[model samples]
Target: MRFIPSLFTLAVCSSFSIQADNAETAIERITVQGDLRQQSLQQLAGSIAVVSEQDAKRTSAQHLDDLLNQFANVNFSAGASRGRYIQMRGIGERSEFVDTINPSVGILIDGIDYSGLGITGISDMAQLEVFRGPEASRFGANALAGMLNLTTKGPTATPEGKLSATLANYDSRQLAAQFSNSVNSQLGYSLALEQQSSDGFIDNTYLNRDDTNNIDEFSGRFKVNYHPTERLALQFIAHLSDQDNGYDAFSLDRNRNTLSDEPGQDKIRSKALALNADYSGLGFADFNGQISWLTADSDYGFDEDWSYVGIHPDEYATTDRYLRAREQITLDYRLVSTPAGQLGGSDWVLGLYVAGKDYDLNRQFWNWDLWQADSFSSSLERSNAAVYGELTTPLNASWSLVSGMRLERYADIYSDSSGNAIKNHDMMWGANVSLNYQVNNQALIYLLAARGYKAGGVNGDALAKAADGNLTELNSKASFKPETLYNAEFGVKGSALDQSITARVAAFYMWRDDMQVKGWLNPDSGPQFAGFIDNAGSGRNYGIEMENRLQLHPQLALFLSASWLKTRLGNYITLDGDNLSGREQAQAPRFQYSVASDWYITDALTFNLSLQGKDAFFYSDGHNARSKRYELLNARISYQLANWELAAWTRNALDKDIGVRGFYFGNDPRDGYEPHVYEQLSEPRRVGVTASYQF
Candidate 1:
C-alpha cells in the first residue's frame, strides 16, 4: 500500500508537464521575532520559515498546531494525549503540565510568551515565524530546541473589518470576526472573536456514542495601541479562551488494557493580559518593558465501567490550576554607529525578569472515598534576571562578524502537596558567535553555533504512581536536571533569475545531555499500571533542511521543502532492568517531507495543492514496532468578488487511513505476545466552504 504512493510521488516529479512548475513571487520584507529584518528568504542567516496571514488564509489553517504540522522540518508527537511540542533538529520531549512546558521549543506572541498550548484562541494573527536550532539566543529559557513566534494584526490604517463563516462535514461550524479602527491619530484598537465546534470522527467502542466525541471552542482577543509620541508607544492586549473536548477513545477489545477505560472528557479555560511600553531613539538609548498575567484551569475525568467490570471500579478525576504573573524590563544602549566602518555598531541590552506561578493538582476517586488522592496545594515561585550585549563589526566590504553573551541568575521554590518547601538556585551563562559573507546583493552565507538551556522540575508521573500505591511519604528527588544542547549550523541563502526565485539550505548537528524518557511498570491488578520518568541517556540529532521557491510565470508559483533527519540515542540505561539498549527513539520518525504549489487561474480565482508525508516509528517499547507512514493531500479553490471572498477546500482528499498502535494487558504472560492492537483512527476527509465579507 505504501509502495504505490512512493511510485506516485516519483511520477509527479518526473513528469515533464510544466503545468506550473518552479514558480514563485516576491513579497514584502518582514522583521521576524522582533529583531532581524530579512529582506528576502535568500538573505536569512538562520533556519527560519515565515507564514504570512495571506498564506494562512489560503491554506484555511484552523489552528496553530495544524499549520506547523504540515510544514517541513517540523515533527511532533501530538494528539489528544501528548501536548504540542516543536520538533526541529530532532529534539522533542513530552511534558503534560501547564505551569511548566518542557518545550525545548519556545512560543511567543508579539514579544510576550504564550505559555499555554491548550488554549485555542490564536486567531487574527498577522504572521508566524518558525525558527530552528540555536538561533533562539534572543528568547527566554524555553528555547533549547526552537521558537514559534505569532504576531497578531494591529490596527488598520482605515476602519477595516471582516466577517467569515465556514461550514464543513461532520456537523462542524466556524464563525470569525475581526474589526480594527483608529480611535484617533495617537490611539487605535482591534477586536476579534471566533467560535468553532465539531462532531468528532471517531466512534467509541464502549460508549457506542457519536456526538459525545465532539469538541467546542470559543476565543476572543482585544488589542489597543497608544502612541503618545513618535519615540514612545504603549500596547495593551487581552485574550480569553475556553474549550470542551473528548479525550482519545480506547481501542476495541479494550477490556484487557489497563489504561483503556472509557473515553474521558476534558474542559480547559485560559485568560491572558499584557501591557507593554517601548521607547526608542533616546539619545543612543532605548527601552522595552512589559507586564503580563496568565491563568489556566483544566478538569479531566474518565469513567472505568463501560469496557470491563471490577477494573478501575470508580470514576477518576484530576483537576489542575496554573497561574503565572510576569514582569520584564529591558534597556538597550548604543554608543557607536557608522555607515561603513569597524567598531561602528555596538549595542547592549540589560533586562530584569520577575515571574511567579501557583500550581495545584487534585485527584479523587468517586466511588471509593478511601481511595482518594488530592493535592492540598502546590506553588512554584520563579525569578530571573539577565544582561546581554551584541557587537557587530564589519571587517571589510564583504565580511562581517557578530559576538554576544548573556549572564543570568535564576531562583525557584516549590511547595508540594502538603505545602512543604523545596528551593533551588542556579546561575548560567550563554554565548553566540556568527560569521557572515555576502557574495552579492542577493546571496549570503553564515556559520553559527550557540548553547541553550532549559530548567527542569518535579516528575508528575513518578509522583502520581507513588501516591496511588498508598505510600506514606516520598521525598522529592531534587527536580529533574536541566537538559542542555549545543548546536552547530552552516547555511546559505540566495536568489537567482532576477530575484524571482529564492532558496535556502541548512545542515545542523546537536548533542543533547540529560535526556528524559518514560519507563512503565508491571502491576498485579484488575487494571495493571505504573510509570515514571528517568534520565535514561544522552542522544544526538543531525539533520539537513532545504526549501525553494521559484516564480515560473506571473500567474504560477512553486514551493518545495524537505528535511532528512537522523535521530538516535547515543547511550542507554533502563530503570527496570529491561536491557533495552541501542534502540531507536520510540516515537520519533527519521523522515518527513512536504511539497506545495499555487496557481492563479484567473483574475478572481486561485488554486492551491499540497502534500505532506511522514515516516514510521515504533509504537510500544521499541520492540513491537508498527509502520506509520501516510500521504495526505489537500487542495483549495478560492474566488473573489468586489467585497466578498469564497473558498471551497478539501482536507485529506485521498482519505488515507492512519493507525495508532498500542499495547494491552493480558491475563497470562504468554497471551501478551499478540495482545497489541492497532486503532484505525483518523481526522476524516473533510470538505468545507468558507465565505468572508469585508467592510
Candidate 2:
C-alpha cells in the first residue's frame, strides 16, 4: 500500500521528465529478428514486448524462473520439476500427464521450436521477444496465441571474452563464460557455457533434508556465420541443456514442509541444431532457407501420497513415474520477390514449411502390492505441411496494407500397449490483414484482423480408464476436434519527446469456437485424478495492454507495463457434472501490472527497483478454488570499475507467501478424503551477489 504513493509520484514526474539529456543514450529503433524479414517493432501492427540485451544482463537471472514478472499477462506452471509450461493472455496448458497437447503459446530459440520447455537459461541471450497475438500467418498453427523468442548473442566484429559468477542464499551458485570474435570478414563465431545449481527452498521434515527440491542445470550455445561467396551467407546454431531437479513440491499442509518418503525427479537432456542459408544470386527473387533438428529425453514422477507409511494407520502407499523421449525435425524455405519480380509496385513473399515429430512415453504406477502395479507405454507421431505467403503494398500516401495467409495439413498417429489405436487428421488455415496509418513522423495507428487454429488431439488411455470406471458423467469423446479463434485488435505506438519516451497501447478481442478445455476423471473409484481435454461450444477473451518507458535523465529511466483482461467459458458439463459455464477461465487474471525504475547514482554505481502484481485467478477448470492476489518487490544494485563489476540483488524482498499452483481435491486419509485447498508455493526471499570480469 505504501508503494502506491511512490508509484504515483514516479508516474507524474516521468511525464515531465522528458527534458533532453545530451549524454543520455537515445532510444534507438528496435528490429524484431523473428519476423520473415527485418521490421521495426514500433511500426508493426501487432503487440509485442521486446526485452533488450541490456535489460537481461541487468538482472540476476539464471533461468526463466527469475524473469516471469518482467512480462505482463505472461505466466508459467511449476507443478513439475521445472516451471516448464507458459501461458499468454490466459491461454495455454497448465500441466501435461497423459495426452499429447497442441501448445497455444509457441517458444523458439533462434527460430527453432522449443515449446513447453519454458525454463531455458538466459546467460547468453541477446534479446527476448514475446508476441502477444495470434501469429498463425507467420509461423502456422503452433503459434495460435503467440510466440516467445530468444536470440542469443552473435559474433562480434572485435574479439571479446567475459567470465561471470554468482553466489546466493540457499546454497545457490552459478558460473558462466562466453567468447565471441570475427576471424575474418567472411567468418565469425560465438560460444557460451554455463552451470547453475541451488538448494531449492523446500524443507523435508520426514527425510530431515532441506535440499529435497534442488536444482542442477547445465547449458551451452554455439553459433557460426560464414560467407563463402559474394551473394550467399550461411549460419549455424547448436544448443544443449541438461537439467536434473527434484519435485517434492506438494505438501499436506500446503506449505514449504514436505513429508513424502519418495521424492520424485524432474530431469531432461536436450540437444538441438539449426542451419540457415540466405542467397541473392538469383535475379527474380532471393532465397532464405532453414532446417533444424531437436532431440530430448525426460523423466517426471512424484510420490502419490503426501505422507510416508506408518504416519497413519493403514495408509496407502503409491508412486507414479513417466519417461518420455521426443524427436523433431523442421524445414522452412522462403522466396522474397526482388524488385524485378514485384507486381504493380507490391513486394511479396512465398514460403514452404514441413515438420515431423515423434513422442514416446512410458509410465510406471506402483500400488501397495507389487503384483497389482500397472505399466503403460504409448507412442505418437505428428507431421505438418504448409504453404504460406504474404503481400505488402502502399494503399495511399498515409496508409499501408499488409495481408498474409497460410494453409496447413496436420496429421498424427497414436498407439498404446493397452491395445488402443487412434489417428487424427485435420486441414486448417489461418490469415491476417492489417492497415497501418501514419499519424505523423513519430506515431502510427493500426487495425488488424486475424484467424488462428489449433489441431485436435486424443486423450490416450484416459478415455479407456473413464469407460472402465463407467463414469458416464465424464466426457465420452475419445478425441476432441480442432479449435478456431477469431481476433480483432487496434493500437497506437511510437516515440515521443525526441525519442526519449516510447509507448505502446492496444485493445484486443478474441472469439473461440470448439474450444478445448481441461477436465479431470477418476481412473478408478479411488482418489486418483487423470487429465483429459473436451471440446466446448464457445468462449471469448478481451483485454487492453499498455507498456511505457521514459528517460528522466541521462542516468535515470522509468517503466510501466500493465494489462486488464476478461474471459468467460461456455456452458458445458464434463467431469461428472462439474459444468463451468459462465465462469472465468482458469489462470485468467483480471489485472496484472509491473513498475520499475533504473538509476545510475554515479559513474560507477547503479540501482534498479521493481514492483509487480497480479489479480486472483482460478487454478483449474475442474475446480472452484482461486489463487490469492499478490505483489512482489525486487531490487538490484551494482558497482563497476574499468573491466570489472559487482552487484547484489534480492527477489520477493518481503518474503511473502504466494501460491504458484493450487488444486481443490481430497487426498487426506485422516480426514476421510475430504477436499482441501492444496497448493505449491513459489520461492521465498532470495538474496544473491554477482561478479563479472571482461577481457
The C-alpha TM-scores of every prediction are: 0.84, 0.94
* Per-candidate local distance difference test: 0.62, 0.82
Worst 10 residues of 2 by lDDT: 7-16
Count of backbone collisions in candidate 1: 8
List pairs with backbone clashes in candidate 1. Answer: 23-550, 23-551, 23-552, 23-557, 23-558, 24-550, 24-551, 104-145
**Lowest summed lDDT window (length 10), candidate 1:** 14-23
The digit string of per-residue lDDT tens for model 1 on 127-185 reads 78878875434665667777877888778768999999999998989999999999898
Question: Which regions of candidate 2 deviate over 4 angstroms?
Answer: 1-27, 367-371, 466-475, 523-525
Q: Highest TM-score: give the candidate number.
A: 2
lDDT of 2 by residue, 1-695 (tens): 34434433443343334444541344346888887765778667788889875676555667776676677777777778666677777777887776767888888998889886664678888888888878899888877878888888878889988899999999999999999999999999999999989889999999999888998989999999999999999999999999998889998877899999999888989999999999998887899999999999989898888889987784677888989999999999999989998878888899999999999999888632234688778899999999999898878877889899999998999998767788889999999999988654445678999999988988875665655455444436678898898889977676664666777777789998988888886545365666788887888888877678888898899888888789988876766667688788888888899888889999999998988898999998777899989998889999999999999999899898877788888777777767789988888998999999988
Task: Give the lDDT of residue 580 in candidate 1.
Answer: 58
Error of 1 at 55 (Å): 2.1
